[model samples]
Target: MSTKEMFLTKLKRVIRTGFFNFWRNGTVSLASVLVMMVTLSVIGLISFSGAILDTSLVELKNKIDINVTFVPGAAEADILNIKQRLESLPEVFLVTYATREETLAAFKERHANDPSILAALDELGENPLGAVLNIKARDPSQYASVAEFLESGNTLSSGGITIIDRINYFQNKTAIDKLSALINAADRLGFALTVFLAVISMIIAFNTIRLTIYIAKDEISVMRLVGASTAYIQGPFVVVGVIYGVVAGVLTLLLFLPITYWLSKVTENFLIGFNIFSYYLHNFLEIAFTIILSGVLIGALSSILAIRKYLKV
Candidate 1:
C-alpha cells in the first residue's frame, strides 16, 4: 500500500479497536466520562461566574460619579447653564438635572410613611431642597476634577450661584473603592482556585487512564507480537480520549446553560446590559478547544506511560 493508504488503514483499524474497547469496558469508560463531565462543568461554571461578576463590577464603577447639590434659591437658569457647562467637559459621560421640587417628590414617594418629615416640609412653606446635578464621569478617578470644577466659585454670575456646600462625593468614595478592591480580589481568588483544581483533575484523570490501559498490558504485548505497529496500537486510546472530551464538553454545556439562564433571570436588573447566554455562546469555541486539547493530552500521556511501563515487558 502507498504511505497514505497505509496510514488510512491504520487509522481505520485504530478507530475500530477504540469502539470495541469502549463497548467491552463500558462501565469503566462511563465512569471516567462522568468524572470528567463533573470536573469540566465546575471549571466552566467558575470561569463564567467570575467573568460575569467582573463585568458587573466594572459597570458599577463606571456608574460611580460626583453628585453636585445646588444651594437652595439658586437660579434655575444658572443651574441649566452649569449643567450645560458640565456636559461640555470631555470627562463627563452624562448629566442628569433634578429640580428641587422633583427631589422632594422623589423623597416623599420613597418615605411616604414618615408623617413628621412631611409635616415639617409643609411648615417650611417653600421647598428647602436643592436642585441636584448627577454627574457621571468617563473615569471614576476624574470625579475629583468634576467636584473641584463645581466648587471653584469661578464661573458663576454675581449672586447667580451660591457655592456647593456638600458634594456627597466623599461620602461614596470609601464604599466604591472598597467594592472595586473586593471585586478584583474575588477575580484573582477564583482564577487561582480554578487553576489549582484543574491541575489536580488532570493528574487524577491521567493516572486513571494510564492504569486502565495498564490492565490490558498482556493484550497489547500479544498484539505487538502479532505484528501490530505503534500507530495501530496507540490509535484506539486517542480515539477513546476524543470521545471522552466530546461527551464532557456536551454535558458541561448542558448543565451550565440552564443554571446560568436561571441566575441571569434572578439577577436581571443587577446584571443589566449583560447577556449571560451570549457570553457563553461567544466563548464556546475556546471552551471546546480546551476540553478537546485536555482530553487528547491526557489520553496520549496515559498511553505513552502505559506502553513504557507495561508494553515493554
Candidate 2:
C-alpha cells in the first residue's frame, strides 16, 4: 500500500477500535459520562447566573426613572406637551404622565391603612400633589443627556414661566452612577467565576475519567506489546472520551430545562416575574455550544493524559 493509503487505513482502524472500546466498556463509559455531566452542569449554571444578574440590574434601572414634578396648578396641557417633547428625544425610551388626581389617588391608596396619614390628607382637603412626568432612557448612560435636555428646554412654558417645580434627577444621580459601575463589576465577576468553576470542574471530571482509564491499563499494555503505534493506542481512548463528553453535554442541557422551569415558577411568585426558564430558552443555542465544546475538549484532553501514563508499554 502507498504511504497515504497506509495512513488512511491506520486512521480508520484507530477510529473503529475507539468506538468498539467505548461500547464494549459500557459501565465505565456510563460512569465517565455521569462525571462529565456534573462538570457540564456547573458550567451551565454560569448561564443562569448571568441571566439573573442582568434581569435584576434591568429591573433596578427601570425603577430609577427621572421624576419631573410640575408646580401645583400647572396646566395639564403643558404637562402633556412636555411629555411629547421628552418622548421625541432620541435618548429617551419612555415618558409617562401622571396627572395630579392620579398621583393623589395612588398616594391615598398607599396610606389607606395609616390613619394618621389619611387624616392629614383629609385636613389638606385639596390635592397638593402636582402632575409628574416619569422619564426612562434607552440606557443608563443616556440618562444624563435626557435629564439635560429636560432641564435645558422643557422646564419652562412657552410663556417664559417655570412650570416644572422640581426634577428628581439629582436625587437619583448617585444611584445611577453606582448602577453603571455595578454592571461593569458584575460582568467581570461573572466571567471570572465561570472560568474558575470551569477549571475546577474539569479537574474533577478528568480525574474520574483517568481513574476509569487506569482500569484498562492491562488492555493498553497488551496493545503495546503487539507493536501498536502511540497514536493508534491513544486514538480509541480519545474517541471514547469524546463520546463521554457528548453524552454528558446533552444530558446536562436536558437537565437544565426542567430545573429552570421549576425555578422560574418560584421566582415569578417571589421575584416579580423574572423568568429564568425564558432566559434559558432564549439563549439555549449559545449555552449548548459552550457546554458541548467544553465537554468534548475536556474528554479528549483527559483521554490523552490517561494514554500517556498507562500506555507506558
Candidate 3:
C-alpha cells in the first residue's frame, strides 16, 4: 500500500477498534464518562461563581471613589491645574471636575425637598461649595497609591497656597482596604482551587484508565508478540480515550442547561443581579471550548500513561 493509503487504512482500523473496545468494556467506559462529567461540572460552576463575584465586586467598586474638595476661595485656574495633575496619574481611571457653580446647583437639587436647608443656603447669599474633583482609581488596590500621591503635597498650585481642603479617601479607607484584600484573596483562592480540582480529576481518571488497560493486558501482549509497532498498539486506545472525553463533554453541557436554568432566579437574587443561566448562555462557546479541551487532554494523557507498562509486553 502507498503511504497515504496505508495511513488512511490504519486510521480507519484504529477508529473501528476504538469503538469496539469502548463497547466491550461498557460498564468501565460508563464509569469513566461519569467521573469526567463531575470534573467538567465543577469547572463550569467555578466559571459561573467567578463571573458572579467579579460583577458584584465591580458594582461595589464603582460606588467607592475619592472626592477632593478645594477650599471655597481656591482659584479656578489652580483647581483646574490640580485636576490636570490628578488626570496624569497612571493609577487614576477618571477625574471628574465639577465647577463651584455646578457643585452649588447639585447641592441645592439634593436638598430641594428640605425647605430649611434651601433657606439656610439662601441666607448665606454666597456659594460655600468649592470646585470638586472626583477621582476614580483603576483598581481598588491603586486607591492607596493615589491617596499617597495626593498627600505628598502635590496640591500646591502656582502660588504657595494649599488649595486642597480635604480628600474623602480616609473616610472610605477601611472599606477600600477590605475590598482590595477580598479581591486579592478571591483571585488566589480561585487559582488554587482550579489547580486542585483539575489535578484530583486527572488522578482519578488516570487510575480508571489504568484499570481498563489492565483488563486488556493479555491482548496487548499478543499484539506486542506479533511485532506490532508501538504507535499501532497505542492508537486504538488513544482513540477510545478521545471518544470518552467528547461524549462526556457533550453530556456535561446538556446537563448544565437545566441546572443553570433551574437556579437562574436564585443566582439573580443572591449573586447581586448576575444570573447564572444568562452567563452560561452568553459564554457558552468559551465554556464549551475549555471543558472539551480539558476533557480531551485528561483522557488522552491518562490512556497514554496507563498503557505504558502494558506496552512492554
Model 1 per-residue lDDT tens digits across residues 1-313: 9999988987888888888887789887887777777667656756676878778888888779788887787788888888899999998889999989898899889889999998998898988888889999988889988878876875474575574646888899888889889888888888888878877887777777776777778888888899877767777876776677667667767776777677766556677877776677788788667665665566566566656665553
RMSD of each: 3.2, 2.9, 4.4
How many backbone clashes can be found in candidate 1?
0
Give the residue spans of candidate 1 off by over 4 A: 139-144, 151-162, 226-229, 257-293, 311-313
Give lDDT: candidate 3, residue 142.
88
Candidate 2 runs further than 4 Å off? 73-81, 157-161, 176-191, 310-313
Which model scores highest in lDDT?
A: 3
Which structure among the candidates has the greatest TM-score?
A: 2
Candidate 2: tens digits of C-alpha lDDT, residues 1-313? 9999999998898888878888888888888898899889988988777777777777777777789999888988888888888888888898888899998999889988999998988899998899988888888778888878877865678788989888898887987778868986887798798879878988988898898888888988998999988898888888888888899999999999999998898877755758888878998999999999989999999999867988775
Candidate 3 is scored at a TM of 0.75
lDDT of 3 by residue, 17-84 (tens): 99999888889899989988887777776777678778877778778889999999999888888788
Question: Alpha-carbon error at 86 in model 1, in Å?
Answer: 0.9
Q: Which 10 successive residues of model 2 have the least lDDT summed?
A: 267-276
- What's the CA error at residue 145 for candidate 1, in Å? 3.8
- In model 2, the Cα lDDT at residue 69 comes to 91
Identify the superior model by TM-score, candidate 2 or candidate 3. 2
